[model samples]
Target chain A: MAKYLSKLSKSTRSNLYTVTAILAAYIIFTVLIATGNMSNLLQGLLIQIFYYAILAISLNLTVGILGELSLGHAGFMCIGAFTSAFFSKCTVDIITITWIRFTIALIIGAISAAIFGAFIGFVVLRLRGDYLAIVTLAFGEIIKNVINVLYIGIDQSGFKFSVKDSVSLNLGEGGQAIMNGPQGIFGTPNDTNLTICVFLLILFYIIISNLVNSRSGRAIMAIRDNRIAAESIGINITKFKLLAFTISAAMAGVAGTLFSHNITILDSKKFGYNQSIMILVFVVLGGIGNIRGSIIAAAILTLLPEYLRFLENYRMLIYAVVLIIIMIINWNPTCIAWRKKYSIRNLLSAINKKKEA
Target chain B: MSFISYLIKGISLGSVYAIIALGYTMVYGIAKMLNFAHGDVIMVGGYILFTVMTSLGQSPILAVLASIVFCTLLGITIERIAYKPLRKASSLAVLITAIGVSYLLQNLALIIYGTETKFVTSVIPIPTIKLAGGNLAIPGQTLVTIPVCIVIMVSLTVFIRKSKTGRGMIAVSEDKGAAVLMGVNINKTIAITFAIGSALAAVASVLMFSSYPSLTPTSGAMPGIKAFVAAVFGGIGSIPGAMIGGILLGIIEILGRAYISSQLADAIVFLILILVLLIKPAGILGRKMNEKV
Candidate 1:
């Protein structure tokens, strides 16, 4: 373990900086929680922030690394949320044995979501750009509608077997329900302990960071940059894209499982296209393909609405204005020109190629 | 006999979708970007018509004209604000901005109009005419909608084929750099395209509201998506192709719902899209342009 750690440290070289930053963040989180001045509402709000952050990071895996735009990611989250909720409500023991149930739920949810993701990836991953985006969007809508219909079960033998009446699952009246149709499933057991959730989130961050730096990650990046070129060089674009998508979907499922278990509620509306877009916003606003940037952007955007509560009726307007400003700044010609002129890495790479030749 | 009536009804419904699909196709043809907010602009047009009809208590004809003007202005505004800045950016950036604009418009409508569905009275009279063994009844709105759509489509075809600005728009869509070199004002042409497309959306909205008198803030989302599918089905950047695609999609959706399970409506449409994409990625009416890789 020590040797591995040393090797990791040597490879990263900037490990100390990251470690210190993480430690500082942990300290700050603890301090904020310990302070009595922070209301329970604020704490709950922070938990929600962390939940979305996990989702955003997971989605970034596909959107950033694979360079594929999936508008239907929320569908996978819905699958995860529903599957976990169904299992957790299967027996009282599962609910009571919180920690074990949580772990089991995450695993099951992730696997199921990954399977679904792989299935979709096999079919739609062949398409690129706008075609992929539209198909994914359609897939998401289909899932939502199907879930909506299936949630209300058929009448059986005079005894209506609704999601609510399913035996072994007793999450109060609302909790046991699979998905309460339009009203959404309620009584979800809030088993996501804050510390564990944060820890899992950090773990995911590490995994993604590692994946982005690995050989497989480089191959995925190459595919994104030039698919035809990558394929010509013996890189299997289809295989790598599917792998990335599956991993990303699994991460999203994990996030959804945590969310469902934590919030104790599951709504199809919560997993709609809007939520998918919201996650995409976090990825984009944070500077796509940048892990640190994605995390920070997710946290800030998640928390921004809460801080802007005072805006009241004008909150949406203010939000729109802010978005417009960000877009304008990001699109400024001067900024583009500067980036193009001073792209040192590209220049250095050019020089290196010349030297090698 | 009723089958014939259903077919007519399907055609009328398809016509509305075709009108909306034109906007999507034209903008995509010139811009190569899916204006996700285009449907919301239709919603905006509906709301404007609603406001005009209610406040002024004017005739439906006048209200529709007003709505068209409002939609044209809104379209121009959207181009100026949301799309103009990202004209040179990557397609992804423009697509995201389009989504942002869509959300912004939907939420704005929600705030302004409230979440509750608003009722709009039918502007066109419902009339019945006997044809075969059964009576063939066509909504007066269909008569108006069909003729108006036909007129607009024909005029647009003529404009695109003959007029200098229309030719300029086509030229830009074909080759932006060459068109610019030939003294076509790209910005002005783009703005004009948006205006024309949005105005068409407004007309469809008015007709749609007449057919179904309830309006909600998010009503544009599904219609917008369907129109997009129509555009894709015909060919993304083809004008007449959009019309054909829209009508066909409408017929398929309505007939599918009537004949097949209503639950399968959305699935069938998406299935068609996927199948089309797999078979002919350039779309049925769309010509394939070879890319220099």
Candidate 2:
């Protein structure tokens, strides 16, 4: 294994390690699940963990790779969730096959989110750093608020949309109010399962990892490091940024599709500022720009609160404290120096030196 | 007549936002970091006031003072513990720490307060002013809030213009390295900015809860965000800009609620922010920042 790793390029080697670790975890969890060793709570959380991991990785493309701070990722996810859920609700009877229906919903979700991403990206080009972060936050809140008041229904004539109350939708005979504004959509199909989630997660991971290693990825990184320098060097900052942002938004939408399908009901309130911040926490804590780190961090942090259910009231409090401590340990200069000095590599090398002596 | 009353009510609400925006502007001007936890400080102030007036049976004035002092101390402590160590770190790290602190404060409040909505008795003793044969009646809270906002803004402007420490803050904001070379105590100046900003937040809490009455752990969040929008609208680093921005935002919000759907009022406010940023990124009063290699 060591010899083979040495033969491969550095990026390929890292990719191998990440993929292998994920597969290993997947195999172990599947075995445990098959043997009925996994608890009910853990089993229920599996799909949620997978979606959150996907969200984190997608967010990493913007925050870590693109070198921007976005506080509205959940907004994109919310868009994806609502649009796809709407599609599924409308086509429930027309689409006989569940898998085909779900596949279309996923596509719809991704495409809708990507469109929003492109629009937001257009506005995003005018701002930088903290300003960009704030605008994105504003946009996210707007999306949520707008969704809250939206009323949608379908009649024999066609689909009806109204920002007013459900009565304003004015349906004909056999017409149903699919989305009842604030009450949200009901009866979304529970098509999400652990196997499908894990499959999608691996697929997204490969897509993102490959994108990161491509030439477009380098241009995005260049813009992130130094916008002026990148522009001066003939990189099309606008094109690359919009591309990355749209892709990231699309992935977030996919995560949203998975989320909405996994549950029986969907509410726009779930895609609030708090949810966005929670995903950001996953991205930040997982080590910014590190894809593998994002996955592991999202998994651990998502599971931490669930497992800490024993802590009761202290669960969130403990979570907050852990968040702070982890940030300090990860980013503090002195801590970084200390970590460098006492890393496992140094320890192993010291042991070998001692043996030689 | 109702329109006139709505205008007054809008001004009053805007005054509260102006106060909160002042805090945001000051901290941003000097520290150059968004103190996301600033909103929670307002909530903390509200809780302190509630405890003092209701539980401790204190006078309203004393309660207000106690809240201000506690919030000031809280702000300073937060800067020292959570933010100071990360001063040399990336903006991303500082931002994350601020967010963590915000969550910590919110969760701590949740643990202590148990998510119950606390109704705060009005501390302002001013009587409601009735006019135009009872067609217009402005609440006592509005009477107190608008004047208080004007007074704070004036004093804040004067202090920044005349005081030595205030000059230090301006110096630091202009260029940190240059300010340090000029013998300004960078840490002390930053701490003072936080103290002053958090103090204004406490005042905003008193005025806000007096009018709104209901207090919750998340009460400060929406107003905090709107005030931030106000700060940005007026041009972030300018004091006068915050006041103007706050009042305009308040009027817009009120008018939007009255004429447009109340549900979409927030959306309108945020939409305005996006438009303002696109058209005038530096804001109404903000100076254009030049990039240097």
Candidate 3:
């Protein structure tokens, strides 16, 4: 086993370690829950942590790997949440098998978000940097606001859609409003569980990590490092940018599906600029381009606020302070210098030399 | 007549946006970073005015002046503490720090003031102007805001074009390295830009609260983002651009609310912004910048 592990490349080994770590964590938590060793509060937070970590990973693809600042990630999540919730609600009676129904809903959500992502990418990719960021932000707000005013119902005549209020939906006898405008969708099956979320999380991680290691990933990174240089080398800038963005959007959609399924009701308000910023916070704090760091940061930051519930009014205050402090430590020149000089790799090398001496 | 009234209201709202956009444009011009906390500064300014007028029983003039002074100092302090250390960092790092500062300001406000919305009394004492035999009565806020916006815009333009420090700002924005080579104090110029921006935020706060009559910790957020959109619309880093963008956005917002579904007005405004960005990426007044190899 040791000889086989030694033959694998460093990247593959690291990937193996990540997958094992995640699976181990899932197993340990499942055992804890099964044996009644975990508290209800902690158990409730488990799925949310997985989804937020997924969000961080998705955002990291755009911000960290692709080198684009997306301020409207929540918009794509909104599309996923609403679309998935709408699907689940409409098909609950039709599709009795719980797992099958949820699998379809997840696929629907991801595909819809991917479609929107491609459309937005096509338009916004023409611009660069800050302009692209603002356009995305605008797109996000438009999605949320438009979703807020969208009223959908199903009757004998088929699906009825209205931008007006629910009263205008004018449902027939035995008909029901699936989406009641600003009130949002109610009774979305609480189908999300730790098992599915963990599976999806692993799947997403694999996809992103594999993408990053592939030739396309190198092209994307080249575009990020220097767009002009990448273009000079004959890389299809639009195709790669759209590919990364669409995949990122689709992953965020899956996360949104997880979120919607975890809750009884899904509102567009949950997917807004603030949420986008929060996810961005996760990606930024996690160390840009460091997949593992994003996961760790998302997990810790998501759990921190819940744990700090003891602080009451001061919870957010402390959270903000911690965010600022972490940023400084991570990015400050002096701190970076300090970290470099005493890094674990250097320490390990030094210990080897000392033993040889 | 109602249409005229709505148009006036839109103009007034646009004026408020113009002021806030000025702050954003100026900071972006000199410092080349989005001051996300600029909106929160407006909130702070509103709170200051509320405390001064209601809590401390001060006059409106005094309240406005006090808010401006406090916000200016706040801006300078924020720049010195949070931003100064990040001058040479990546733009994303700076943006995240700005967001952290924004969160810090918001949470701090939450701690100190709680979540209650403070209804502030209008500081501008101008009475409603009854035009055309009371058929179109312009509110006092509009009467004051439009003139105030015009005066501020004109004077600010002059300041940038004529004043020594203002020219220093232009130099810094034009070329940071060249500015330094010419012995321009980059730090001082950036700090002053922040100060001016924050001071404009305070004025915007006064005008905004007077018209809207409500203040919350997050009240500044939407407007701040809108003003940012406005800044980008007019062409980021251009003073005149910020003004036009703000007014245009404000008019569109108000008109969209009045004519279209009020609920989807924000959507319409944003949609228009997206459409405009598609056609002209740099914005109406923004100069076209070419990437150099």
DockQ top scorer: 3
By lDDT, the candidates rank as 3, 2, 1
Residue pairs with backbone atoms closer than 3 Å in model 1 (clashes):
A175-A187, A188-A264
lDDT of 1 by residue, B210-289 (tens): 88788998888888888888888888888788888888888888777788657667767777788887788767898876
Candidate 1: TM-score of chain A is: 0.83
Tell me chain A's TM-score in each of the predictions.
0.83, 0.97, 0.96
On residues A1-357, what C-alpha lDDT tens digit does candidate 3 reach at each position? 999999999988998899899999999999999999999999999998999999999999999999999999999999999899999999899999999999999999999999999999999998888888899999999999999999999999999989987778889999899998888999999999999988988888889999999999999999999999999999999999999999999998989998999988788998889999999989888889988888988899889999999999889888887877777777779888999999999999999999999
lDDT of each residue in A103-201, candidate 2, tens digit only: 999999999999999999988767887778888999999999999999999999998999988999989999999998998999998877877788888
Q: Tens digits of per-residue lDDT for model 1 on A134-214?
A: 788777777776665444321222112343224423334333334555555677677777777677777887788788889
Q: What DockQ does each listed candidate score?
A: 0.46, 0.74, 0.78
Report the C-alpha lDDT of model 3 over B1-293, residue by residue, as the tens digit.
99989998999999999999999999998999988989999999999999999999989999999999999999999999888878888888888889888988998888888899989999878798898999999998898899999999999999999999999999999999999999999999999999999999999999999989888888899999999999999999999999999999999999999999899999999899988888999998999998888
Candidate 2, which segments miss by more than 4 Å at Cα? Answer: A1-4, A351-357
In Å, residue A226's CA in model 2 sits off its true spot by 0.8
lDDT of each: 0.80, 0.91, 0.93
Ranking by TM-score: 3, 2, 1
In order of DockQ, best first, we have: 3, 2, 1
lDDT of 1 at B118: 86
